[model samples]
Target chain A: MAAGTTSSTEVPAKGAGFPPFKTETFPSQIFWLVITFAFLFVVLWRIAGPRIKGVLVTRRGQIDGDLAKAQSHRADAEGASAAYQSALAAARGRAQALAEENRQRIGGEIDRAKADADAAAQVEIAKAEARIAASRGEARAHVAKAAQDAAIAIVARLTGDTVAADEAASAVRAVTGG
Target chain B: MAMNPMEQFTIKPIVPLHIGGYDVSFTNQSLLMVVVAVAASLFLTLAMSKRSLVPSRAQSMAEMSYEFVANMIQSSTGEDGLKFFPFVFTLFVFVLFSNFFGMIPGSFTVTSQIAVTFALASLVILTVIVTGFARHGIGFLKLFVPKAPLALLFLLVPIEIISFLTRPISLSVRLFANMLAGHTMLAVFAGFVVLLGGAGGVLSVLSIAPMFLIVAIMLLELLVAFLQAYVFAILTCIYLNEALHLHDHH
Candidate 1:
């Protein structure tokens, strides 16, 4: 095998020289290299390059748009929350005011009712006093009449004779007066 | 059989064809070049055919490669340098595919040839020179003139010019030498394994050493393949940056 390889290489080296350094192969190698390289360059430049660039550009645009949309949605949510808070505060204030007004109105009604009751009680007390004074005066007159009758009767019985009615009456009056 | 490692580097004519006076025969090297170009194109195009907003696995790979090259250019050459994105992308993908495909057994490594690497390096330097001259005119020559004392300018300027002129040579030699050396080393070690295994006796058992070494080197070669491609693209970016910016730090 060694001898075979040596003979093969020797035969080639004699005629064509070392393969990599051989001037004969330079033109062919360069020729094909130029052709293939140019073909690749054209493919990349015209077709593949633009495709990749487009995808990248599209992705960037999509990401930016999504971010902007997210920002707007967040702002909307914040606005809604703020409005809800303000509305709740207004409702709370109105409820408190209504409660306070009701309290003051009810208190005023209680005070007016108490004053009316007190005035009505005072009038009833005055009427009861006047009635008691009139009743007492009438009772005193009845007692006096009873006492006069008893005196007249007793005098009549003791004298046993018909005396003047006027005289008896006058005597009773005088005693009572004295 | 004692295989000659240099045999793998030979360019045999696959199709004999002549154009006028030149022997433009399609060889194994040419076939691999076409394959690389076609494979690269297909990988990129087919992967992105869906154009999915949420990329699939293949799509992600395609996009990743695209972004990788794009970012490299952007960082090295700045935003304005993006105009040469297609050119840079082509160079990267082509060289990357060539190196990777060559790793497969029985495949030719197009980038292993000095002629091929030299052509690519020449292309980069040519683009730089044309762009520099078109953009800055005579001011582009000021790149060779460093900010130094008048006494040192005479010395420094010549050195800078020579270095500038050797850019293509260095760039080409770096890639070509790396590929050639790596492939040759792998072949030599593989040859050892075969030769030892055929010897019989304890030598057959001892073949495991070279076999293990070959695996290690293969893994290293894979890394080198990727690194060399990245290095080539980044260097192109650096050269383009120099042309575009001249003396500006950015």
Candidate 2:
């Protein structure tokens, strides 16, 4: 139930005053307020406050550590890439050197084989020249024997006498200039 | 049907107790204060029980509120102001929960009482004065002295001192008046609905008007509740900033 406003004046009579302005309740309200508020402050300061701060600090430290780990991983990857590239280049240089050496060796072998074939052809030409000279000398001697036989037959028929073998030979020698 | 709008602000003692001849009885006001404190504590503590690297929905909410207050203090008072973080955080949560809980119909709005608001405001001002003196020693008095000429110092100094003295009054009155006025208006409109509805015939139908108005006022009150709490916390920060860094504003 609601209480009616007392009298015409703004102030209400005793025990019916505006509840907010009532002085009697002040001590109790302040007393309890102080107690509850102080309790709350202590709870927050001791328990809740430290817990929150710890969580936040831990999260920050973890993030920093993770970032540092990521940075090192990236550096390791880069180093590996550089090493791989250098190894590939060295391998390529070695292959080229091997190819160049093989080409030079093959070129020298081809030049030596050509020189041996040229010297064998020169020896066969000298042997054929020597055989031709010997054959020419034998042919000239056969032609001189045929001429002497023909000269002896002609003397026998004309003089009706046989000439001496030595004389015939001398005659033949003089004519042919042997 | 004609109810007194002021009836909602009444303080009835739930459990009577006499301590040293003073009436420190447990009242409805006291009940809500305990509830607010417990609820705020549980909200933060239970939500953070897991303490996972990645937060859950409840945990995120807890963290967000913590960071929200933390950032507010940081921006206004800088990092050094963070030393008072627990105090500022408690004040914000208490006022916020009290306002929200009061929105539930039939629940008491503790901040509406001048005693409670005044106590809170006084605590803030007192902290400011103490911190200023502790940090700067005698230099704290320089807060009232401006960089003006010698002749204008006399006039400006008094004005500054008066404003400084009235900080608690203004702070307390702002929250109390807003809550009291808003609640009172809601009560009055709700009373109008009952009155009009009981008048019978066409008057009953017209009661819908006041009912709609009540809804609108309620929405506004919700906004007011949050705004007042924010205003209280921010003003506290600004005052603390002044105490911490006197003459830095110039």
Candidate 3:
């Protein structure tokens, strides 16, 4: 009994449930292999391949669309920037021109006013010079008349004789001197 | 000498079936792989058949799986990621179901076997290579040459090429190792309980502790199931990105 038990234990349970298959043989391995490969290729090709391809195509389209949109946006932004710069430059030029035109208009008004004032001052100076000359001439004449009247009164008193008013100046002088 | 439960790890030929000069013996392991695959297809079909707006429990689970895979693809690959959603989703479901099916009593783990895991990894790598060539043609060879300082290129290029080639191997090994190690541990621990219980030793009852621990580990393995699937799919996405962009992300 001990020997029986030892042999069973030592023999390492062989062929109890199922039989062993050989792998070294070429035909059997190739046969099973062909079966597995054919099944895999068919299943993968029919079921999985189409779905994968669809997904890839969709993704490629999306990326292309995004790139196109980005390019258009860049172009729009560049155009806007250019437009803004041009508008800004034009506005600056217009502002400078308006300011220059305003300055010239103001200067022209001031110059015209100054010229009118000078002309009026020259006219007043001319009137003042004519009045001064006339006043000087009248004063000289008054002094000469006064001196002749005093000489006539002295001659008339010295001569003690009747004399006409028109001839009194010369007659009085002769009378006063004699 | 006591007969351990794990003595069943040895390969045993059952049915003497030959196909085209090759021995295609039906083994316990292959039966389990079929069971896992069939169970997965049935569950998904039954769950998604209703396609209800307000989902039933099974339908919700199905929808959740779909949406989860969909979201992963979209986030990782971008909106263009939609193309690969179905492939990624199918991969996630198959791997997840295979992992979960292994947790059931008396089922074989297809992923635990190197050949199965390698086959899956090869498929992913093949897709990457094919897609790269399809998209970029011969220029795809540029993925190997690093555009760096001329001096650094000599050092970095060889290392990069090796790492790139290691991807499929590492991917296969990660899944295979995890499944193998987890299943082996559970089997060993289970053997402890069975062997000890038969002896009626005090430690026989104490096996309950490790038994409970094993159950917990199984649950953790289920979570690992989802995680491994996600990692595999995401790595595919990363590789696909390298192919699409040809910018060998070192």
Candidate 4:
């Protein structure tokens, strides 16, 4: 099979276009193959390899960037949800506190009103008692004065004009049938 | 009539040049390789040069060829495989044009010859070697060894080594044998048609049957041409896999 290297059929004559290499020589096809291989290696290493590497690197970076962005967005969304929850709690607390304060204030006002009413009623009752005492005293004084005047008038009529003070009292008592 | 149509399948010299113990003959085969290479480069470059957004017919053809290589790379090696697009493209175009060109009468099929196939196979192996070395450095030698159950290494290492060496041989033989056998059969059948012909010879008329069979075989050969190119590129990808993913201990 080594002689299978003789790829040419047969060399006929001088003018025949025999390949530069013997049929048994290095395969001419190997020459072309080497040339092709070298050319491709250079082409790929220089142009295509760099481009492909660039694309792969860029794609990787893009994926990494996207994942980072997604993570950040998730954090932001969580923060927003927490903020909303806190705000809602604060608003509810404020409303409840306001209601409680209102209830306490109303309670304080009702107590004050009751105290004022009690004080006013006490003052009114004291005024009524003072008025009743003053009227009773005046009536007692007027009754005494009227009784003495009646006694004097009866003594004068009975003793005609010459009766003495001591006699007059006694004569008045006798005249009136006391 | 020639004794055998296979006999006519010869590579005689067209121009003989001798240089110091070197038998340098410019033969039909060499001329055809030059033609195949030149035509491939020219056709693609000329057709794709304008780079129009809306492709012209020539540009469409160029784009189709580009798409073909690109798709082949993607399918064999996955999308990450697009990195090898240009190399794969050039190889496909060269082989495709050469195979089709060989089908023409009087044209030499370089790929049909073992030397040509061997050269191509060697290139693939060389790429694997260089890429593995470049990618893995000295660690590439570790490809032959199993890192686990040291006893299993006894069983696996030699087989692994043999398989590794066999890549180029199998790659070359598969392409060469298919191309050579197909062409030879066609020639042998054509010879039958000629040798059996004569007046009142029923056997001569029956020779037409082989001609029909040859036509069917030719169609099969065309399919083989595409298939062989595909196999070569895919095998390159598999070899590249070794470079990308080093063997685990197991």
Candidate 3 residue lDDT tens string, B34-138: 555455555555665554444688756755665677777776666765676655665666567667777786766656666666777887788778878988999
Query: Ranking under DockQ, best-scoring first?
Result: 1, 2, 3, 4
Model 1: CA > 4 A from native = A1-3, A6-18, A117-178, B201-206
Q: Which one wins by DockQ: 1 or 3?
A: 1
Candidate 1 global lDDT: 0.90
Worst 10 residues of 3 chain A by lDDT: A13-22
Two-chain DockQ for each candidate model: 0.42, 0.32, 0.05, 0.05
Worst 10 residues of 1 chain B by lDDT: B1-10
How would the docking of model 1 be graded? Answer: acceptable
Question: Which candidate has the top score in DockQ?
Answer: 1
| CA RMSD of each candidate after superposition | 4.2, 5.8, 11.9, 12.0
Candidate 2 lDDT, tens digit per residue, B137-232?
999999999999999999999999999999999999999999999999998888889888999999999999999999999999999998999899
Runs in model 4 deviating more than 4 A are A1-25, A32-178, B3-5, B18-21, B78-83, B146-148, B198-200, B247-250
Question: On residues A1-178, what C-alpha lDDT tens digit does candidate 1 reach at each position?
Answer: 2344552224333344566888888889999999999999999999899998888788889899999999999999999999999999999999999999999999999999999999999999999999999999788667666666676688779986654556655676677782
lDDT of each: 0.90, 0.87, 0.66, 0.68
TM-score (0 to 1) of chain B, per candidate? 0.99, 0.97, 0.88, 0.88
Minimum summed lDDT over a 10-residue window in model 2 chain B is located at B1-10
* Cα deviation of B12, candidate 2, in Å: 1.4
Tell me the fnat of candidate 3.
0.10
Model 2 off-target regions past 4 Å? A1-15, A93-178, B192-219
Q: Best lDDT goes to which candidate?
A: 1
